[model samples]
Target: MSVTYLEAIREAQAYLLEHDSRVYIYGQDVGAFGGAFKATKHLANRFPGRVIDAPISEDAMIGSAVGAAIEGMRPIIEIQFADFSTVGLNQVVNQAATLFWRTETPCPITLRLPSGGTSGGGPFHSQCLESIYAHFPGLVVCTPATVEDAYSMLIESVTLDDPVIFCEHKYLYYHLKAESLPKDALPLGKARIARAGRDCTVVTYSAMLHECLEAAEEMSAEGIELEVVDLRTVKPLDTDTIIASVARTGRLLCAAEGWPWGGVNAEVISRVVAEGFNLLDAPPQRINAKDTPIPYHPKLWSVHRPAAASIMAAVRNVLRS
Candidate 1:
């Protein structure tokens, strides 16, 4: 049976609640209202005291989750919109990120950020800030591409000793679907190749992975084969798999839902260039959202972000170069 991306996320939450008594979820409208995306729909009724609805203050919600994690509870805190995470920067960066450094208290707090564009959420609602969390040392940032990974990574994230920024793409919430997920899963730090090829390597995650896959299939018909590597875990990135792919194809292109300046692509391109610079026919390229906020109207939305055509152009440029 096929399961949508939202269903996979719901499964992950339900599994955590059933498997671990210490695992609790707190966010805006996450309980009775079942969250803005309804990923937690009916979960409040299922887990009476566990699925809590917090106030609109992201700072307070993160602070509460941090305190709970310190006291031996695995708290999964949702920021509602990834854009609103700016208000809770202190709790995320200074407090939750440095809890172990300050003392021996392991903050097993999972910050679930519903991020990325494509929903016409404007500047105030949609944004990809995973790179901001990646700047910190103690946080484990993850953005799974497939349904199976979305289902399993959430479980693995809650079990981690450090804080994790679990980024869920709003664009991919229900767009992606897969037949029954695997009962057993891989570790959190691994990357998966959605499509194998001997040509250029297209590194992407979240909603952009689907675009890359579509572009790759289209490009394949034109005799330009491209391998798609989904970086499931963004923070502790699987550099080994990335470098190996680059070594095989001798070229790489990164497509992320983040801004062009100082995003995950910069970090990934830097690592590849520093370690695997020799394994390139041309300098690595990236297809990222423009360095601006997402617009509201559908007409202006196309100008703010990268699309399949943009990614295909980049891949073709790599091939031509």
Candidate 2:
């Protein structure tokens, strides 16, 4: 059955709840009102005691999740908007992320963040803040692009012993669909090659994966065989996959929905420069959000994001360079 991004998330929650007794979910409006985006709609009714409504405090919610995980309970905490997670930075970096490396204790909290721009949510609600969490050690970060991936990897995140920041692109909630999940669902700590080609490799994740795929199709018409790599997991990056793919294509472009400066693309490019520099036919290029707050105006919003046209242009430029 074809599914939306919202449904994919609900399915994942159901799967986790049924598979493990220790797993539970809670966040703002998650109980009686469903979620702000209705991703967790009907979960409270279906699971009863398992789905909880949280008070209006991101820091408190995260702190409670950290404590729950430490006591052998698997908990998933959702920050209503990715921007709200700023209120919980102390719990994420200083607490949850450091527990393992500091005291040899396990933290299995899953921090689910709905991020990205496109809904005219303005600067506050539409920020893509995965780069902030990626900067910290001992935290695994993931952003899924497809509905199947959205379902599978979420289940995978629940089984991991480490804390994870799972960033779901809000713009993609209903923008794409897929028939069904793979029988052998994708595991954490791995990347998927979305489209295979011998020309240039377009490395991206989350909402930008759709842009890169569209660009790849457009590039095909112009005789440019583009390979698209969905770096499913940003933290604990699968650099080996990136290096090998770049080695085959001899050119690389890292695209993301976040701002260009210190974005995930920066890390991807740095990895290429560090390990795959010898395989590059040209310097790595980046097609990312313009270095500014996400504008509220529709026209300006269009210009602020990295679209297929921009990615295609970058591919052509890199090929000629």
Candidate 3:
């Protein structure tokens, strides 16, 4: 039987709860309601008291989870949406992100953000906040593109003794599927070469990886090879793998679902220029969501975020440059 990306996430939580007594779940409507996307469906019943329902306040949720982590408990906190996480920005950045640095206490807390845009989700419910979280110190921001990574990385996040931002795209919850969960995966902080090519590289993460892969398949008939790299974790970025991909392809195109300015795209390009300037045959290019609020209309939302055709155009532009 095939497992979808959403199911894989649920399995990961199940794994954590069954294996680790210290690991508990805290979120809004998670106990009986099973979460906004039902990612935590039935976990409350299966794990009994381990799965809890938090107050509607995002700040309180993170704050309480932080305290739990301090007392040697690993807490998996789920925000209803990526945009709502902003409400707990202070706790994440100042408290959880700084716990280790300030007093050497391990804040083993996992914040699962159902990120990225879905049709009609609008600005409030849909957003990609990976770049914002990745900017801070002592936080590991993971963007799992595949079903396997979604399961494995989340499990890994709970195991680590630091704050982890789990950016699981909402679009892939039902759109993507896998035959089975991976027994072994590339270690966290490493990238995967989703598709290899010699002409140019497309560096992306999360749901954007699907669009880049689609672009790669479509452009193959035109004799334009496109290499695609899935940066599994945005914060602890794998610069070595990314630079090597650029060295082989001689060009880079960074595509992301977030806005273009100062995002993962910009971070990748800056690193390549600083550390692998000699490897590029041409300047790197990027394509991202337009600089505006996420539109509610499906038609406008489709064009707002980077898609296969837009990724194709960016890749072609980089190759031509």
Candidate 4:
């Protein structure tokens, strides 16, 4: 009786709709078509008028949701892909982000991004925009890896005052599962230590967390312990936990599915060197997707993003240094 990451998300939305009348679902084909990924399957029928579909315009979808949120409604806008969310950048960054500060009215909007690269998705459909949205002032960026967090975090997101970027990895929708939905979860902005070790630290989130865990387990066979930390939410990153983990491990390796430049990996490495430089025995390293657009070919896509083999190689490098 395992619940998948996709199912967990559907359940979470169902819970929100049942519990909170203020909550509603809005996005392309979400009402009758059940969304492109079927994340909203049967939701339109169950919730009738509440689950409404919007025009094809991403900017308009977000703009209306932002306005609805400001008027005391909590709207969840589902972007078909994380890459497509860029179309609504102005509404997200300019309107939803600063509404609370500029007008004193909380804009509680949750933007669900079907994020991360999958085989055949290519560059247009595959992208990790968590780091980009996290850069904004009034946005809370969440990268949920586990089914538990997927269910719990989304429910929490719509309730918050600030706009939330929900980065749900497309790769994990069916691949990751749990025995039961979580009743309660680690609060947003808290990092979870997935595995404990003293040799080195691998800080990661979302789908990359699973890959890092696999690498850590493989390295254990060689007596090279790798501590794995899962940063549940990227914005308001839990630096205290990350710094403390590096202090114990004496080495750091930041990993993410996004590109290396100005991404979560860069931020983690920068923080460690800036705040916990004395604790490290070697220079902090980071593993990221190659600096190129995601390719359509399976072979090319396989190597484009960080994988277990790549992460293992990275840990071995940290150990050597």
Candidate 5:
């Protein structure tokens, strides 16, 4: 039987709950409601007290999770929406992120943010804040693109010594699926070459990875091969892998679902230009969501985010350059 990205996440949490007594889930509507997207469906009953619900306050949830982490517990704080995480930004960036540096204690908390845009989700419900959290020090930011990574990375995030920002794309929850859950997975910080090519390199993560792959496939028929790299974790970015791909292709294009300014796309292009300047035959390019609030209209939302057509156009521009 095939497994979906959402099911993989739920199973991963189940695995964590079963193996670790210290691991507990804390979030709004997470207990009986099974999270905003049902990523935690039936987990509360299955795990009992470990899957307790929290109040509506994001700050309180994060603060309490940090406290639990300090007291020898691993807490997974599921913010209902990625956009709502801003309410608890202080606790996440200040306390959980700086705990190990300030004190000798390890803050092992996994903050799950249901990220990315779904049709008509609007600005409040749809946002990708991986880059914002990645900007802070002492935090691991993971953006799992596939069902396998979704299952495996969540388990890894909880076991880490530092805090983690787990960005699980809401768009991929049901849209992406796999034949089976992975038995083993690549380490968290490593990047995966989703497709191999020589004409150009497309580095992307989360939901945008699928778009790049689709664009690559379309371009292949036209004799333009595009190599696609999935940067699983944006913070601990695999620069070596990205550089290697650029080395082979000599052209780079970064695509992301986030906004254009200072996003994951910009970071990838900046790194390639800085370290692999000589390896490139052309200037690296990037495509991101339009610099505006996510629109409520389905048609407007579709064009707001980077899609296969946009990625293909960007690839062509890089090739022409």
Candidate 6:
């Protein structure tokens, strides 16, 4: 049976709860309501007290999780949506993120953010905040693009000593699938070459990876082979793999679902220009969502985010440069 990206996440959480007594899930409606997306469906019944729900306050939820982590409990917090996480930004970026650095105590907390855009989700519900969270020093921001990465990276995040921002794309929850759960996975912070090519390199993560792959296939028909790199974690970026990919292709294009200003794509291009200037045959470019709040209308939203057509156009521009 094919396991979807959402299922892999649930399985990973189940595995963590079953094996680790210190691991518990905390969020609003996470206990019985099964989360806004049902990622924790029936988990409360299986784990009982371990999957307890919290009040609607995001700040309170994060604060409690941070406290739990400091006391040796590994807390997995499920924020209802990525945008809502801003309500508890202080606890996340200041408290949980700096806990270990300040007190030399490992704060092992996994903050699961249901990220990315979905139809009619609008500005409040549809947001990709990975770049914002990744800007922090101590947070490990993971953006899993596939089912296997979704499962393994989450498990790995809880096991780590630092705080983790698990940005599981909302759009990929049911759309992406795998043949089975992963027994072994690439280490976190490693970039995978989703599709290898020599004409150009496309560095992307989360739901954007699939868009890049589609663009790559279209370019291949025109005899242009675009190398697609899936960045599993935005923070602790795998610069080595990215530079190596650029070394071979000599042209780079970074794509993301977030806005254009100082985002993950911007960072990718900045690193390439700064560290591997000699590897470029052309100027690095990036594509992101327009600098405006996400629209509610489906037609407008369709053109608002980067898609295969836009990605292909960007690739063509990079090739010409």
RMSD of each: 1.1, 1.1, 0.7, 0.7, 0.7, 0.7
Q: Per-prediction TM-score, please?
A: 0.97, 0.97, 0.99, 0.99, 0.99, 0.99
What clash count does candidate 5 reach? 0
How much lDDT does candidate 1 score?
A: 0.89
Candidate 1 clashes: the total is: 0
Across 114-198, the per-residue lDDT of candidate 3 in tens digits comes to 9999999998888999999999999999999999999999999999998999999999999799999999988889999999998
Task: Give the Å shift of residue 182 in candidate 3.
Answer: 1.3
12: Cα error in model 5, Å: 0.1
Please give the range of 10 consecutive residues that has the lowest summed lDDT in model 5: 263-272
Segments in model 3 whose C-alpha atoms lie over 4 Å from true places: none
Alpha carbon deviation, residue 109, candidate 2 (Å): 0.5
Question: In candidate 6, what are the lDDT values of residues 183-282, reduced to their tens digit?
Answer: 9999998999999999999999999999999998888999999999999999999999999999999999999999999989989998999999999999
Can you give the lDDT of residue 249 in candidate 4?
A: 93
Question: What TM-score would candidate 4 get against the native?
Answer: 0.99
* C-alpha lDDT of residue 56 in model 5: 86
Give the TM-score comparing model 2 with the true structure, all chains together: 0.97
Candidate 4 yields a Cα-based lDDT of 0.93
Runs of candidate 5 with Cα error greater than 4 angstroms are none
lDDT (CA) per prediction: 0.89, 0.89, 0.94, 0.93, 0.94, 0.94
Tell me how far the alpha carbon of residue 95 in candidate 5 is from the true structure, in angstroms, after superposition: 0.5
Tens digits of per-residue lDDT for model 5, 187-208 = 9899999999999999999999
Candidate 2 structure quality by residue, lDDT tens digits, 1-321 = 688887898889888988898899989999878899887888888888988999999999999999999899999998899999999999999999999999898999998899989657888888988889999998999998888888888888888999999999988898678786556766887999999999999999999999889989987987889999999989888999999999999999999988888868999999899988999999999988887888898888887898888888898889999
Backbone clash pairs for candidate 4 read: none
